[model samples]
Target: VSVQLYANYAIGKDVQAMKAVVGEEALSSEDLLYLEFLDKFERKFVAQGAYD
Candidate 1:
């Protein structure tokens, strides 16, 4: 499982810096879906105690 705080920070950082630099205008439909998927995945990761 992934560390919850670390995962949250990583996602936030990606959206803020990397996404902005890429000039992504806005989140694509796939990006939104991926974010949701990541959310669920991260939750499971935490629950599974695989997070560090």
Candidate 2:
């Protein structure tokens, strides 16, 4: 699989991109599930309120 590279990094860009957004706490199952739920809930709220 082809990988993307980030600026000034030994790792690939795709890896860096993923790393940049996530944190150590997110490694936990509870944290991950909570984040996923919040993300989906926020998106729905934003979509509903976009025109208001």
Candidate 3:
């Protein structure tokens, strides 16, 4: 459930939203891994849309 929410926000390019959703919890190492992915994904996502 949380992962789904994180993915949605990440794909939507909403880093703040993703952070807000996940920041309240005590993140596990696995969750940290996903956050790193989110950072990269958001960067790529914005870059891909920059020309549009």
Candidate 4:
């Protein structure tokens, strides 16, 4: 679920789901953790090369 959300939010560049996960008030602990993991995943893995 975390990876799917990351794929949608980062790879697809769609924030609706991420914003929904984050909510209007603030980010929850789990969401924060998932975001952290997503960041690391992109930094460490997804940026291997460029694509059109």
Model 3 lDDT tens row, 1-52: 7688566656544444555777726556565666667666567654586475
Q: Tell me each candidate's TM-score.
A: 0.42, 0.39, 0.42, 0.46
In order of listing, the candidates' clash counts read 4, 2, 0, 0
TM-score of 3: 0.42
Q: Model 2 segments beyond 4 Å from truth?
A: 1-22, 50-52
TM-score, prediction 4: 0.46
lDDT of 1 at 3: 78
Q: Is candidate 2 or candidate 4 better by lDDT?
A: 4
Rank the candidate models, highest lDDT first. 1, 3, 4, 2
Instruction: Give the Å error, residue 2, model 4.
Output: 12
Q: What ranking of all candidate models by TM-score puts the best one first?
A: 4, 3, 1, 2
Model 3 misplaced stretches (Cα beyond 4 Å):
1-25, 49-52
Better of 1 and 2 by TM-score: 1
lDDT of each: 0.60, 0.43, 0.60, 0.58
TM-score of 2: 0.39
Give the TM-score comparing model 1 with the true structure, all chains together: 0.42
Clashes of 1: 4
Tens digits of per-residue lDDT for model 4, 1-52: 8668656446323333565766634855555666666667667667767552
